[model samples]
Target chain A: MALNTGNKIPLYQQIKQNLKQRVKMGVYNEGSSLPSLRVLSKEFGVSPGLVQQAIYGLESEGLLAVQHGKGVRVLEKKSSESVAISFGFIQPYVEYMTFEGQIIHYAEKVFDRRNNFMIPKSSEGMASREREIVEHFVQNGVKGIILWPIDNDPNGEFFQNMSHRIPVVLVDRMVDGADLPSVVLDTHEAGCDVARHILGKLNCRRLLVLMDNLVISTNRDLIQGLSEQASEMGRMMDLTVMHLPITDFIQRLNVGDYSQVNMYIELVERQIREGGYDCIFCPQEEFLESVIIEPDMDKKFPELKLASMTGPMLTRSRKYNEFGVIRWVWDFPQMISSAADILQQWVLRRKRPTENVSIQIKQWQSTE
Target chain B: MALNTGNKIPLYQQIKQNLKQRVKMGVYNEGSSLPSLRVLSKEFGVSPGLVQQAIYGLESEGLLAVQHGKGVRVLEKKSSESVAISFGFIQPYVEYMTFEGQIIHYAEKVFDRRNNFMIPKSSEGMASREREIVEHFVQNGVKGIILWPIDNDPNGEFFQNMSHRIPVVLVDRMVDGADLPSVVLDTHEAGCDVARHILGKLNCRRLLVLMDNLVISTNRDLIQGLSEQASEMGRMMDLTVMHLPITDFIQRLNVGDYSQVNMYIELVERQIREGGYDCIFCPQEEFLESVIIEPDMDKKFPELKLASMTGPMLTRSRKYNEFGVIRWVWDFPQMISSAADILQQWVLRRKRPTENVSIQIKQWQSTE
Candidate 1:
């Protein structure tokens, strides 16, 4: 189509648009040189300067590359099309709002302004749905993907197949037997550190650890750490371990499900009465919170000191902090920033690193 | 340059090489379309078919892209330049030979034929040297990197900065606070499983865990798992944990350094006599082997039952098998394949995955 000079749009912009359309239509394919500026100017009934301006505009937009004495060339078709990176997480958006927010914050800072971030709606235990979301991103031209996968994900083969086509960064939990990059907390060490704090620093003679049937690596790591440290302390320490019968309480707690809280309280109370423990440790903040919130439960077990691994929600809560629970805070900002940094390399520079990054654990104790 | 008909090379090949040289010398810049077939044929005094063939050759080599209506265009000036992906690990080549071999095997299968793999010489605790190697790779335009980092890496900041330029996959170990992808064994679960086997199945009443102060996540995970499981089984089990004072002995052992083996044997002998343990758990295969190789140590402590995390080297050993040590085997093929799968996704597709991939632990109990 010919450029209309009488139109309000600038002459250069009109010419640029016309050329862009031709490139999109494959009239001038990628790496295909455009007609010389003189020929274009004569054909468009515009000045040679206007033609030059149009080419320069396209060049600035990354649709065309101008090489001196080599004529203008099409670099890419549909250059202005926004290619967003998609992130898939097992947790629903509302539950992982803080994490989601941090991802966007760091992604914006790292990615080019032209790029955007997309998060598909996902829920716990929806491995099939997670695979579908990933497939959808792959089908579309998503630049990259970040996934916070479900525990014991059954879609390992699907991810392995997808890995052949894109970069996938696992954020929190990882799938066993799926070789994917990840940014995670050193929960095992954190567990050991927490044990050291309780048994070494606090010097409680009798200790009780509360866990659930989630069978996650993090929980295992934490429990293992506490056990090893206690074991190392030998006859000086007496450790009792109890598994919470409440399945998926951590996931439920994230979404504000507290119907099972009473069940947890009763279980903890029974264990305390039987074991006569002086110190109690919960691998997750949600578990600790559930126990402490059981009105008069903390007072009834006044001799018991409590500690747990904290999340952003628990760390920020004034009421939760007031309970005087010792907590381990994960460095979320650093993790997000690190993920962004890795993304910058993979997406922009196209460099694939051969190492996993771990976010260090920060312990938060009541100053009072 | 004029074509030489007398040369042994085909006319089209000669033309392709000449054109390639010209492109390399900047006669035709990237994004610069070449002359029409007719013009090129006329200029070179060659048949139009020969010119067409030469252009197709360049196109196939990714140096040029030829459009149907448009002329041949330079796609990449240095298209034939080989870009190798570099892998850096803290362990020496001979020490981690099987692991290294597995990595290479899987990488070749997953990567494109055009890509090559490079592994620079590295040794344990050489964090500064590792950083320099990474820098060298970046400067050289290495496509991707695989890192088996040292524990408590001092170069976390450097690697994080490098990750902004490329995708990194951490193998076996990870750096805390660096956002990178990884493929690792779930050592924590293995620890728990081993503990269960020993306490429940084998009915070992007393346990001794012998470890070195390498301070790796695997050691911590194993120790934690063992401790937790032992604690859970309580009263029914007695556990003792000891750390060997030897530093880098694990690395040295892998490469066949037995100078410290005598020291280890002496230490174990002292512990066995003092503690009178019936079952001994070595966190690593090397440690187990070191203890078992001490002529008649098993006979000296007749009731001692041994167990360890086995690698390819140890598992294949007839003598090791004869020792009847219960072994936990990491599926190297699966781990490597998973890593390769992750690398393919990150490097080729540029898709960032959001979760970590853990290699499943396989148990190999002695039939005897």
Candidate 2:
């Protein structure tokens, strides 16, 4: 844990709180238009998105009336002047897509704060929105923001090129080329763990790894880590890697009805039967359903098994009864807290934490 | 189709038509912070989310620089800008947890937009961050947004409140209080269609309708529609409704992998053994998988047949060669376009669209 610099908090948050305190003291009347996201972001020298995230947080909390373009107007005085805290993701909760469930679980467990905290919907591939949604909290006067940047760029040009100007803790993804604090699972180790599990426990000869074509940094690292581990296991273990182009497949699924059998499903099943891949690894929850739901797949591909690299348990909804495919649960809270520590350092203008944050993907072995 | 008010045409489009316009202008002038989302939203009187969505679209196009806590800054001069548009949802794209193969097929089709029109990844539950992600596009200067608001609001307060600020259209869910444009299939008719097909075509008598819980408004509509149509078929039809609590099931599975085999997988197998329901109507993809994937489902539940409401073509997948699930493809584009129309009226300060935009959910009977 690091000290909270007064300015380390997001600009919008700083402004909103400043205004909120004034309101508590009767400095500004209620029903008044607050400073715009731009004005506040500029005053605090932070991205407008953080400001927007802060404001939206306040709006959701009923402290702000966002009359569309009319600007954010203070609705009612805070019963107390303490600013609320919030966090957000650019992507939807993991449950909706592949890995994680609703984001609220991870949020509740991590922040564990007394003030109102929020988890924003994850945006699909809209990197810029990732920044803005966080700012929404700042504008409405949130105390801090916890964000999950895209995994690919641990410290990329975006956050590095610009100053965060707020207390932001990065979770899940790393910001490449920058020292801003972040926390993420050791995907490389997770991949290594899965590979070791398959080669060691499963006693499988030919293993095939199937995944989406795009090398999302997280998945890529997992692949690399797995490949490395498999190699280290020596000639006794022979493995082949197949990168299936599932991007189009995912897109089609998004547009089409949720009620029919499609080609990709057929292909994976075919792979399991014809390709003779001993074990299948699916990174997302969506894929898990397909494997387990197939009627007696154990009979169809008796040699094949399933595994997954998943987010925290909080992301998984109550409906996931059978954990047939997922061999492990990558607890997101531990890593998220670590990432928050790094972000807090950046906000406080402290020298970046020297500790190298790494993750180990754990696996639950098949008892059978 | 309706006049392309905020289509994907970029601001620099004229440069393609006239090359002379390029070099003569410095355009954005380096380091100039682009107008913040609030400024743009206020200028256009659109919701900040719409603005942010547009801004993200533009940022993706390299038209803007989004700095954290600062307003959007112009990275380089732009020849043209993408206009902003607002959109809504009409139909739900549901998926079964076990049907991975079908998901791939659908993903491919929807995302094949010639590398344009990015749909943000969504988690299961609607996170609070949805608004800010949309606001990013507006700030970046995207031309429009097509959104599927969360389906949980039965009263449609989400769309009703947001429609006032932008050009929004409704998708799968429709509301009476808001005159939002919509594209939808008559779920009731679809249910009726299923009833007719199962009883009239398949000649099945006893039926069990396995539906997801009523968190989604469509779940309620679907149940109501199916009940009405089943009743119309008279005494020949014996209908028993069973709601599958998916949330509970997913959690158990996430915590322990064996929950699937011990709980859901076994329960499904047992249901087949009792053989009370000759036909099953699974309203979502998840339910469809649960009914069909048990190890001995085909053997024990020879009389059991299923009509799946949503999809990922689990049957078409290799796991089940005789996938008896009925398929339905939704008209997502039309639904999105209609929602855009409603949002447009709001953005332009015109009269709200008429409230009678009722959509009949469409169903495509599977030949397989």
Candidate 3:
């Protein structure tokens, strides 16, 4: 099968998986030099830069080596002392979904150390394309899969049935009805924490919670947590919930097109003005830094303390408090590493996939 | 090693582990007859009933068989195909600490199905004894260990360095300063849930939470959760904390001699009368069912409603509401199964142990 340009996975990862498979299948022998970069790039219908990146990844992993002025050559194989535990890595684009990309980065490092291999596949955030890739992996005997499932699918039921065939571990967000193992930040808990900090610490009562959509489990949980906190405080009658048109946007916001930023901004601004809201809470990490609520732009809404769930790199260097927001930071590395651990157990013929885990989120401290 | 009667592990389990080791080491060849029950009982210094139970356990796992006239015979061994993932199971006595024993039962069944094995060990509730068993297993090349760490240990630091030498998964309770993987019920969340249920559902303003000890993570989390809820509602001054004498009693209450339970009962009764508390919350599952606040005995305090975290069997067959108590039923099976999953990942030459997980607890429903 040829590479598809519209795939969400980076071009380099796609090529890397293709070449890795051929090497494992014995189509490419040990010590054999691969075709020149120009020839290989042309064959896969990609630029030479992408092919070189793929080759570099292989070289770094000890799968292949690049001698000075020589083509990439296959290295000696690590024998599977037992059956080599293998998994298919499904991800969105690295540039847009940096949190997920970083997780995959750590997972690959861990897999190498464990003497295991993972092949990545992407369909440009298209659920149908992902389904096809999963089918291909299953038919070809890939043992298990680690999926960063896209929330853009209208049906959202494709993943519900995917895990039935092989062990499928989702990262970052849980699907509503799927019995799949997932490693994710507890948005529900984050919501409760944010509510406490804003209401108790900042002395803010009228709060506005912003999220792309409720279909996403993380987004839905955020609302649930916030509502529960208010109800517990005997303030449910005082809680305000604002919704975006499409569901699952909090999860797939980066992958899907959302050109109407001003519309969401205007809606937020209107709610703050009319409701006399003292705080703005957004559990979606992507939206915290996105244009709709940009840092400098937050100055427009004076006296409004902002709250959000943050990724490791998002608020690390920034003076977040001065930007009028406090973050409940999530450990991205933990989510990725945990998913890999779960996949390893299941693929190695363990009886059943483990229960889904919701990682605890911590209030951001200056030390981190 | 001679079997000790003081072990927390059942005598049958101890003997089962002993015989299993001999079989694996070829001390007893495949199709060979094990020593007669009379000889084995005398040699191990155990009762004949215990020896029979041990042999029966082995037979059920396809490791041995009983013959009509001949002695109990060894059966053909199932090849491990891969490294037979092994863990030493350390637990409390099965008779009183029934919840933990049920967890072990399910874990053993999972181990059998996964083609793995676990040896059982216990020092009752003796911390020093537990340390010796852990040291012995570490030296014997056991791949991993699952410990239901006793809270009675003044220095929980014994478990501190255990995972450094090998993977150690703590079940139910987490040691204070130990860098180990653990699967436990989130007592802190249970604290919050209880606070909400008591304050909102029952509309009770004064709540008294009674537990054997605070060093127990569940009990500590319960207090933390309750205080946080009151604080979140801007009522920190109203939150009450009552401390017991022992630090780790919640964890080892059943094992340690707690004949002074009447002192605890008197304190609770006095507090209820003087403080005018309408509700009593106990996160300790064992205490919820034990005599500190007996079901029929609770009638003396006519207006007080009780709450506790429960195991699967504790409240299942009983009429809970009529007893003047509500339960936050915890899924022990989920806790055990999740720990099994975590252990499986660490023992198979994986790079790092996964993060500690706290299983979610749900409120009891009539349907369950």
Candidate 4:
């Protein structure tokens, strides 16, 4: 097809459209090489510069791959049919690397076969890095984005601007004041569920809750849920909460330091031995691994029914019930899938939910 | 192609395979009518029953559509290419309907375009319904399943059996000793986050944490986090947890019964007027909506900073910050995506993580 020089459309765009149609009609099949730029220019009576520009446009769209010596090859036929809708999934560092990997993997597995996903090569929870990732995805024309935003992100304007252009679904965290769709867990209900299990089902009256130094929103929800449940069972329940400073321990552990680990372990042992508590609740698994799993801690505190709000590392040498620990499981797949679904709908159908999605929590107990 | 009746392969299956190949090779274009059963039987020199069976098999696989008086029509030329790998997503109920719907939608969006998803028509957290849904998906050959399991599920054996056959990713809740993969949130940390926000950020010296009667794991974790943060701050923090008997209010709210909502509201008003507290923490949104949003509550408690561990219904008439309220947003999408990813891996590659995935929480303050 010859270019319409008098048309309002740019010359390069006109050439690009013609070649795109030819590719769609199977004149240029996938993996097949395209005609030389000189031949195309001569045939269309257009400058070689226009032909080069058109080819470059198609190359960026992932329809063509340019090889210096082998010539430009059609990477996909029926370009429109073969062009998968792309999505960007951005997170702050891979804290849960396997879990994050699985989310991307499963999202692709369950997503439409013609859709594609892109994630950052490395993320450090830095505002600059986050901005870079977001801008890159936007420039690449990703249909939508699923972000695990940085806590108290400073790049609110960037996110707000991006949201206006395309659907942005915040995953794990959200930036304050940014009007974006989000999918969050119902940790309040999770706390209530755990409290019910402990007070109603397990019939524990006097309980001691052990906590660490890290302050987070989930931690607050759990406390509220527990307090509410305890108050509901008032007089029948006696609860005491003990907070330990573990920021040092955590930082040291991260650097292969274990000196303070024993100090915290001994302190926990003392609390269990001295307090007349029917149940002991540890909010993190570090306490279980560092203190409870000691040689005969289970025997020493056989009467002390143990519960945690974290998952048990099943692969660890210590097994649940062996040390009498019960834990809760978070529904990550549901959260990821839901975010993807919402983002897709927002991108394809321009539909957004009236409220944020909240995933539920599950309880797990070891069977001996 | 003639049927090989003498061979081990059934005549119907052989014919079905031959027809399938032709469809894939574009011999029978999409939407074209196929020969009648009698005509096929005569042409293949086989019994009509075998020909009918072959056609029926193809029909079930979505290759052909049969109509009364009309012949079997090719629905898809590349039938197998379009068939999606389906997974079952079963939940007791969509109490969190928006959230649940988003999870399913995002899962599908990120899931392989060719893979499909199925859900129960109606579920009531009943063991029978759960059993039926699981069995149906299994019978239909779903690659895997993502379930919001019922507590103390009666169909333990069934789940165990299915786990042996295909991958099962448990969401929301889990049965005791099921040995299934799960994803859960860290409510303990959520609780800590709130405590730090109140005592450290807001500089609240005297805090009254109002809790309801529901005893759940998240509740316990929240209380633990609060107490831990409080203890770490030592003399700088004075915390009092008041448990209110609001089970009736909660039940009514669940079923659209708001009569007792006033009584709970009045109680909260009285507590604020006389309790001599600097801050009030509510674990759920219902309490904040019913009590704190009253016409003059904000004016009456001008010094009190309100916080909750749930998302604020932003579209509601009541505005946050205007009513001195801040809520935490849980990252549900991250949880769902993570779960979908893990489940997909387990189903497609037989890979399971050593532990469950936990999505974090974020805080949102009302801009108004």
Candidate 5:
């Protein structure tokens, strides 16, 4: 920290500018201690009083925390220097889910067009990996994190602590109690749209919804939407939302563990056959593949029609793709683009929105 | 017309009220000759001047038309009395397509809640039948008609004529050149969404879009969307949109002509095989049912994938419903409810919107 003190500009003010540059460059990160006043004073060949004045000015700008026994600490870096700052985007899964890559791709395009840069990482479906990746981002001093959280509330504490370090805009899967700004697709409304379709179009009275674990916010929201629609319909619809052992199964599947995939598919098929349901709706694509693979599904359950809500690649099956089950889907192109918009606004504007932005989910159904 | 002359109400006013009641009850319909002016005066025991004044009043209210030689005839029934009046809903097809009944059902529910009534008619997939239905609705003095037009531009002149007679709201299938208020789905955007998904997720450089005749607005919209997406991608994608002779074929299928079904399916199959395409998107369910029914479609074209768009019941094919061909669907419940809202607003307020209300289309896909 060499200051050009021969000029009319005071040594302390020059020192203050140098220190702010260090903060902007993330040389001293949030919650990290800066050099002692005496050390900084010596480094700058200045008096202790001048160094103290420099520190005080930075403090007034809300850039530092002064402590008597300890040293000054750097606060969160949300200042203007954060513009076009490096952002970390953690894809919820390490594995190549269809929309995951698209989310990264679309987000990259938008961020690139604005001359900002984003670094993407994968959680690898592991909470530990998620933690590690996030910590790496923080340590690297990325300006912000646009998080698409994984399920089971594994990183609640980590999210809260991370929020203090930098701005985080969640591409929300509806993590409750996080109290963070999020961009959420209105999955509940999507569920209601499904219910109305099943009742009004398919004329189905008994509806069975098979999906991921209800602990996940998206799954819960879809079920709540269905239940609310049923309630609103008033005796027109009866709904059953069944949650699988998704925590372990999806984890295994994520890691290429397919031994239990058959078991899960069979469980769903048995439920569809014996449950006396008029319609089945699955928002998760995990079981959709195996369940609809049977050649004689329509013949076995003549009265049963299935519906689904998911992203791209779930429409591979022609049995229901061309005819029976309806699907409600949200793609990465809209969702990720929306999240990127919110993230840019939150980071660039230096003011985060308190409310979560709810986007309408699209309805996909085929008619004969 | 019965008149109670001894009452405090004036004789001419009483005659006007009776004639107004006759018009309100549709005793004298649009474009039909009302009772002669002299005949009206003789029957009401009033002067021709009084009857003429009554006619002028009704004419001022836009309820009747008076010609120099011809007697008063009822004009369009788009007046404020059209409030809560019976609205005619004409489905694009006469046969039970899943969404057709649903549109009527949802529309009826909404209309019923407001103490209004609706009479639903099926066009029977015949241009002639569509014209007949509109003429019948007009003759019956239905205050408004919510028209879901048949394809092939068969009803363009009819629609323009009908708009003048009633507050007609077109559930637009992107019918161009028709200057009318419409409630339309944003199918062009939906098409672009499909294009982005194909490029971003499916990673297909060679694209093929197969559907009904491009003369239809919906098909054209979807194709245009795909083209625009390709254009926006700036040579990352090459799109080919092909049309089938859907007019005669769909009409025959509507009336249960399955003689050429296999031929049509084979034609699509040959195109898929010879095209060397990476993915195919079909927005019309009419061809989707025939295209994907080949159980060995994936085996035959192992590298090919498909996408589709339509209303409920087209997802019956479990093949694409589960895995490969993504589906973009719009349901009748939301659509009909929205259309009903517009119709109610148009008729009750005696004002019509010039812009088409575009509802977003939803995407459905499966992942491996």
Candidate 6:
């Protein structure tokens, strides 16, 4: 490790150089905890502040990391010798779901990056390109992956043809007829509950269901669930479920603009004016927020109601009770924690995870 | 690598197993791309659908990952990897910030998470925890850290210590004597600009500045900027700044209730009506939203006006815009891109970056 000696380099820089040299000399291996700053300060006969400065300097340099609840451990350095782990994510921003955050955070916490992990960018639309990227990671000797699959069940073959291989844990979305360990929300139940709440308490005769494209299993399952529930309810409910694809919606409303929302409200208003539907059941929070801004609910359709299948934000909102958003809890930490446990067992004992290891999401409906 | 037999275990599962084995054997590496389902299907003489199913299965199993725009890649198997470059965040749960989604999404796109990245969660009141976490990561050999430093530099000594050992990149905030590399939003400019927009154009003389705790540097900079601007304007403008720490405010105003918002409005009303303030400038979006729900500005104030630092939601809200909100554009992607570029240069090239790189923020005054 290079040591900074110039006074302009700061005292901490000088101390950090010594520590780096120790690491280079194999004094500190991955996962080994370092001495406390105070202890080091006393040993070096330097101020604790200087020691701390050194530590922070190393941390900022990516020679060290700081976690909230976990103590400092030697992270595997990303030297030329490090192994790589392949990962794929389907969500637009990977972090869209809080669950994703938990998974990523968990991965970072449990693995040694320098010698054990590698992640490449993954997206849905670029199928061929995604395949190339995956192959590149595999060729370079990636360990395994954690992915949120696309709706299609057949996408799994990409990894099958690879000469090299890796283990995988699915997050959020599920693959049909696949016997891989997976963590997914109970979207079917979530859909049914959303319909039941709107039909039973909100007293809606008709409803419009806004959804994403049905290419993925989640969309198919949600639509199927809602349709089945609606069919069973019969004449008691006149639910006209309108499938508005997000892409089409985006084209009209533009991303991050309210025009699409305004258009949706106008459409809803027209439906209400025509005396068709009594409620709008948005399948997601983005749509739910759209419904919230349309204040004409009291004026145009006095009896019409609105609700959606939403995450924690809906319940956390000040207008939660005012706006009916069905709570759908996805315990990310539990899933990740379990996956880690399973992965560790596999790594340490060479025991494969049994098919029975799966997580089912819990659903709750707010009566109020 | 494990091969699929299209049996009870499912073809996708078989494919996932094959990939997993290859990864473990160091055949597939992190940050490397993988083969597409189509190519894999052709090579294995299986249907494309089967390959897709396998990829999805792998995703569910946490063996493969896909990200938007970047396609599929290998990821680190756990949390203890090396972050080649660390970008500091100034706020807790930056994922919830107006532009944080884009920031993280893009970062995920370019960053090889399998190589390891450090994201330190440092809130204002949690200094001890922050220091401990930083130390742990530093000792682990993290390449760098992306942090949201604590307000008041509560962990100043800790950061100072860490800074001496590793390269730390500060995001969204700047520390006065710490010559660190930072990508920051010009909140000082944001504040002064908002104040000028409202006071100059809206003819708002009396104003109320609602500020929360200085948990992040952005918060403090925003308030400071506004105060500086107000002071510069001198007479004719009556700016009454209401500073409430987040904890104290939450205690006074129950989080779950909207009543607190009403109370704030009533207080502001009293100020405008009795105390003679004509406008209100909330430095943060939460406070801004709270103020927007109050009685109609045109009705209550008539001659009074309102402008605030707001998120994208407020800009999209037609009703909120009728009152006016300073649409502060926090370009998250720019910072992420910058960090990614910096990481590539530092980690991949082994070059020490010069300290202090700042991102400029674009402010949209409510001219409407």
True contacts kept of each: 0.00, 0.05, 0.00, 0.00, 0.01, 0.08
- Each candidate structure's TM-score, on Cα atoms with residue i matched to residue i, is 0.39, 0.51, 0.36, 0.40, 0.40, 0.64
lDDT of 2 by residue, B1-368 (tens): 12123423332331221111111133335567655667655654456776676666556756666778988765654323212121211123222233221222222223221111222223233434345434433332232344555555343554466444344555566555655666565666677777777777788867777666756666676777667877887833477677778655544443444345456666655664564678777665443454355344766666667766543222233333346566554444444444444444433333455643545555655443
Count clashing pairs, candidate 4: 97
What does candidate 6's lDDT look like per residue over B109-207, in tens digits?
545433333242324236575565555444433445666555556565556666655556666666665666677767778777777777666657677
Per-prediction DockQ comes to: 0.01, 0.09, 0.01, 0.01, 0.01, 0.08
lDDT of model 1, residue B49: 92
Q: Candidate 3: give the TM-score of chain A.
A: 0.64
Candidate 4 DockQ category?
incorrect
Candidate 6, position A138, lDDT: 42
What value of lDDT does candidate 4 attain over all alpha carbons? 0.63
Task: Give lDDT tens digits, candidate 2, residues A84-189.
Answer: 3333334333323433323433443343232223333444456665554544434323334555666464335555533343455556665667555556688888
How is the predicted docking of candidate 2 categorized under the CAPRI scheme?
incorrect
lDDT computed for candidate 2: 0.51
- Give the docking tier of candidate 6: incorrect
User: What is model 5's DockQ versus the real complex?
Assistant: 0.01
lDDT of each: 0.62, 0.51, 0.64, 0.63, 0.64, 0.53
- Candidate 1 C-alpha error for residue B113, in Å: 41
- The stretch of ten residues in a row with the least summed lDDT in candidate 5 chain A is A1-10
Superposed on all Cα atoms, the candidates' RMSDs to the truth, in angstroms, are 23.8, 13.0, 24.5, 24.9, 29.9, 16.8
RMSD of 4: 24.9
